[model samples]
Target: MESWELGEWYGEFLDALNRHDLEAVRSLIDPGVRRAHLPRGGEAWIADLGEFFHAFPDWRWKRIQLVIEDDRIAAHLRGSGTHSGHYRDIAPTRRHVNVAEFAIYRVTNGRIAEFSGSSDAELRAQLA
Candidate 1:
């Protein structure tokens, strides 16, 4: 796909995530997508993503920017959610936090095949 198309697709994926539309999210992600940030990767990451939304059912993702190239898309996103559920290894603190995250996704056949990203430490501090 073209770079613009890839960027649009990534935007839609982010929309699905922000909306907590699991079915839409499933449609965008390849069943075997590899997620390098997770321990077991692939399905594990998918599961973790679902859990994240479960914990932060009201999570909102605001797009800061998106850069698309050949078959990759990088998204700079800012998100805010209430700590209503456990996230990662962090227990629920019932606090609200705004987080800034950057994600690079490798797209194949219009599906996200791989993803790697990091969250901003400053954002984490704000939450704390």
Candidate 2:
């Protein structure tokens, strides 16, 4: 896909994520989308993302930078939210967090096929 087209696709996906719109995600992601380098696939990944909204009702994803090559898109992003519920066994601290990550996404025919990313370490340290 062209850079502009890829950017547009990636942008819509990000917009859906930031909106916590699972229906849009379901439409944009392949039924067998991979997660975090895992073989885990299928539509089940939808709820996996919902965990974030469960923990941070106001969660948002912001794009910092993006580079597109063919069907792959790499994005540098910022994620922020307030801890209003338990997250990964951590009790709610009501703390607001801003974290950074570099994510690489693979898209095929406009649907996301795979995604892998890592976020700032300090964000976890702050939780501890």
Question: Which candidate wins on TM-score?
Answer: 2
TM-score of each: 0.86, 0.91
Weakest ten-residue segment in model 2 by summed lDDT: 37-46
Residues 1-128, candidate 1, lDDT per residue (tens digit)?
98878778878988888888877888887788877646544466667778988778888999999998899888898889887877766777788888788889998987888888884465457546
- In candidate 1, residue 91 scores what lDDT? 77
lDDT agreement with native, every candidate: 0.80, 0.85
Query: What RMSD, rounded to one decimal, does every model reach?
Result: 2.1, 1.6
Candidate 1, after superposition: displacement of residue 70 in Å?
A: 0.3
> Which portions of model 1 show Cα errors greater than 4 Å?
39-42, 119-128
In model 1, which residue pairs have backbone atoms overlapping below 3 Å?
Answer: none
Q: Candidate 2 overall Cα lDDT vs. reference? A: 0.85
Clashing residue pairs, candidate 2? none
